[model samples]
Target: MNYVILGAGPAGVTAAETLRSVDSQASITLVGGEPEPPYSRMALPYLIYGKIDEGGTYLRQDPTHYDQQRIRYVTGRCGGIDSRAKELYLSGGEVIPYDKMLIATGANPIMPPIPGAHLEGVETCWTLEDARHILKLAEKGSPVVLVGAGFIGSIILEALYLRGCDITVVELAPRMVARMMDETAGGMLGRWCEAKGVRVLTNTRVTNIESGPEGGPRLSVGLSIGQRAPADLVVMAVGVRSNTGFLVGSGVKTNTGITVDDYLQTTAPDIYAAGDCCEGVDLSTGKPDMLAIQPVAVEHGRIAALNMAGHKHRHRGSLNMNVLDTIGLISSSFGLWQGAQAGQTAKVIDEGGYKYMKLEFEGDKLVGAQCVGMTDHVGMLRGLIQTGFRMGGWKDKLVASPERLREAYISVAQGGAVGGADVAARQHAACRVPWRGERSLAF
Candidate 1:
């Protein structure tokens, strides 16, 4: 059996490994457009902050490891795919035929239409090369202008802060990470960035960019109030879109990305799609959602491999669970929030100092939750939500009383059939409050 994967990103790598595990004698070949081997896309900002060495970003095993596993990797760009011929056309005029193929092409950063965007010192931090370029420019203490206030832009702020570079963030939206979090949570994160010495300009757009008088480049950013600011280096951190251009007219149906069924199989037989370049349904909303997260990609790869290996595993769909660590501020949100649902009930608890907990419940089950500031127990909460826990008829009652809340949560975590009111009473009796009213409640 011949298995050919069209990318070297997380999804492709995992698919290759899974195939090898299931069928040892299968001939596996991984092709990548990047000259370098696979690297952690999530670790790009860490590389920029000098938190990890450059070599640490590489995801591929050493030459000896690949030799032992009998996995062949081809470094080249894929020009197009011939689904009928079962071959991939390479940029270097080479054709690789495959019996089974997995397309994990991933995504590319979206560069907006702005004048002088082709100027030097303007770049996007999507790849290792982009990170290296930004790092080299940072050493010169250049004034940096970062466009977009999404996850990438926020993390880049921390990285540039460690380098002691002057950064001015220009976001067209009123808040940062608008797609991931609500306006209230976004405001809290914005304040945290401000406290850390980042000049965040909201409702601002870059109209044009031009060469500076001396050496560096200058960007003309338009403000909502009608003003302009000069910038030296511009880093565009706008969101990314799926890379499915090569699949066009190849008989593989695609909307925003390559369309795949629950089994991860594309329109063509024996062909599959995964990672950022594929679109799947959301479990909660039952709507088609393209969640380009690493975990989702990894799971998609595993499911695709299972199906290719003649197994009966199906992808259960993905959720929008965003957990981010910006400096020391921890922020996370799962499912949908208030105002996001038309007829949902919401309960909010604000402890001040930028800490908050908001829960949106449709009935007995938790539809969504948002936790910001001092998030130590967010992992536990996120897990509960993912597992689809039902709070019975005690949801509203427990949320209203602080004492009952701990017991209700613990009961749900242990298994929904555990004792309810008795457990709540016992735990509340043992509960102790500290001077700051922030003591551990062991329920």
Candidate 2:
């Protein structure tokens, strides 16, 4: 069997390794667009923070990891695909034939439509090349303008902060991480950054950018609010879309991303899609949804490879989850964190203490949850929501005292027996601040 994977990121790499393990005699070829060895894009920020060197970003430490596994690693740009012929055309004029193909090409960073966006100093921190360029420009105390405060932008903020870059974040949303975090939580994060000496502007957009006059940064950024800031470097972290351009006429369907069935098989026969390039089923909504996180990508890879090897595995779909650490403040959201229709919600807010937790319930089962600073019990939230654990009587108890979540999780998720008396004592020990509840799932 000949297997060809379109990408060498987590998804494609995992698929290749799994294919080799499942069918040892099968020929596997992994193509990566970048020149560097398969490296984790998540580790790019750490590279800028000096926490790791270029070698540290590599996915496989040993040079011969691929060779030992009998996986062919090819570095080339994919020009297009011929689904009818079962061949992949490289821009360099190479055609690779395959019996089974996995499209895990991942995603490309989105560059917003702003004037002078293609200027020299403006870059997107998506690859090794971008990181190298950013490191050179975003030197210590250099003025850096970050155009988005979403997950990627917030992550890049940490590295910029550690590098001593005078950073100013401009987010078009009303709050930071608006997609993952609720208004209150997002506001808290914005305030947290400000407290840490980072200028955060919410509900703002970069209207224009031009060359600076002289003796300063090479660029001047104009804001929607009629403000001008000189920036040595502009990092566009707006967002990303699936890398599905190569599949335009490949007979594979795409809607926001490559549409794949539960088996991760694309519309084309013998062709599968995985990672950020495909829209997998969403567990919470039970619908096709795009989850670009690395965990989902890896999971998609394993399941797709198994099916490709004739194991007949089916992916149940991925739960939307994001855990972000921005400038020492930890925030996370899972499932329909914003709340479901007609869902009962409970929240504990301690802004002065920098702690908050919100639980959304759909008839006694945790459908969504959001938290900041209450990191110890976060895993439990994910567990209860992911497993669809039936809280039963504990639901009301949580509404009364959400801080005693540890007790509830131990009793239900862990299948432990804790008396009600113990629960009361733990509740009292946990927190004294009474939480507020609302029947309406209002914003």
Candidate 3:
């Protein structure tokens, strides 16, 4: 059997490895658009920060990892898929036939809808080439305007900060990471960033970017607030979309992304989809959703490989989770952090202290959480929500005292059915304080 994976990112690499393990004799071809070792875009910021060189961004540290696995790497973008012919067409007109195919093409960076984005000094921090461009352009004390404060944008802030660049973040949303974090949690992050000397402009847009005649640094960004800011470099980390445009004529179905079932198989048989290019079920909403996180992509690849190799496997669905660090402040949003309209909520907001936590519950069961400046008990909260266990009275106690997560967890996770009053008595007697940064409580 020949398995062809149309990406060399985390999804495609994992799928190749899993397939090789499952069906040793099967021929595997991993295709990629860029001419580089399969690397994690998530690590690009660290590369930019001089923490690691280009080699460190690679997902597989060993250069011969793929070669040792007997996986063939093809450097090309898949131009089209001829399902009937079982042939994949590459942009350079290479035709590769496959017995089974996995489309894990992933997503592409999106430039903000502003003029002059194509200027020489503007780049997106999604690929190794982009990192090289940034290294050359963003020097010490460079005036850098990052046009979004989302996950990717926030990540690169540290790198730019280390470069000693003056960063001005512009986000149309009212707060940083608005899609992942609520206003309270996000507001605290924005303020924290400000406290650390990052110029944050929330609820603002970069309406236009006028480049100088020679390009590179001599540019002006027109803002919605009636101000034009000069920028030596502009990083467009606004958003990204699945790279499924090449699948237009294919029989495979697509909404926001390629639709796949629990088996990670596409609408067409023997054709699988995964990664940012595919939309699967969300555990909380029980609806089709796309989360372009690397870990989710890895799981998708594993499941797709198992199914492709004629093994019984179904994806349990990925839960929503995001952790971000801006300046010195850390924040995370998981599950339905924005809580439903009729659900009960427990909120703790200490704006002065730069700490916040919001727990959403649906009748004694924790459903979601949003947190800022508090990392302890995050894992506990995650387990409580993911396990879908009835907290009973512990839920109310947690509502009253959000920091009693250790107590709530101990009550519910004592290895069996727990009685409420007894659990409360035990919590009152021995609930551990100093839970902040307590690693044991986290897990």
List the global CA lDDT of all models.
0.76, 0.90, 0.85
Per-model root-mean-square deviation over C-alphas: 7.1, 6.9, 6.0
Question: Which of the numbered candidates is closest to the native, going by highest lDDT?
Answer: 2
TM per model? 0.89, 0.93, 0.91
Q: How many backbone clashes does candidate 2 have?
A: 0
lDDT (tens digit, per residue) of candidate 1 on 1-443: 99999998889988888888889999999888888777878888889988887667877647455557777988888888888899988989999999989999999999998888888778899899899888877754667888898877887877887887777888988898888778888898888888887788887888777776665345554445566555666888888999998887788899998889988899988899989999876656767678888877887888788788887666766666777776677888787754245434445556357876777666667667777774655655554455566777667675675234456666665543556676666445434421111223321
User: In candidate 1, how many Å is residue 316 off?
Assistant: 1.6
Model 3 lDDT tens row, 8-35:
9999999999999988899999998899
User: lDDT: which is higher, 2 or 3?
Assistant: 2
**TM-score winner:** 2
Weakest 10 consecutive residues, lDDT, candidate 2? Answer: 434-443
lDDT of 2 by residue, 207-320 (tens): 999998888788999999889989999999999999998888889999999999989999999999999999999879989988999888888998899899998877776878
Q: Which stretches in model 1 have alpha-carbon errors above 4 Å?
A: 60-63, 215-225, 338-352, 401-407, 416-443
Off-target runs (Cα >4 Å) in candidate 3 are 213-216, 414-443
* Candidate 2 or 1, higher TM-score: 2
Ranking by TM-score: 2, 3, 1
When summed lDDT is taken over every stretch of 10 residues in candidate 3, the lowest stretch is 434-443
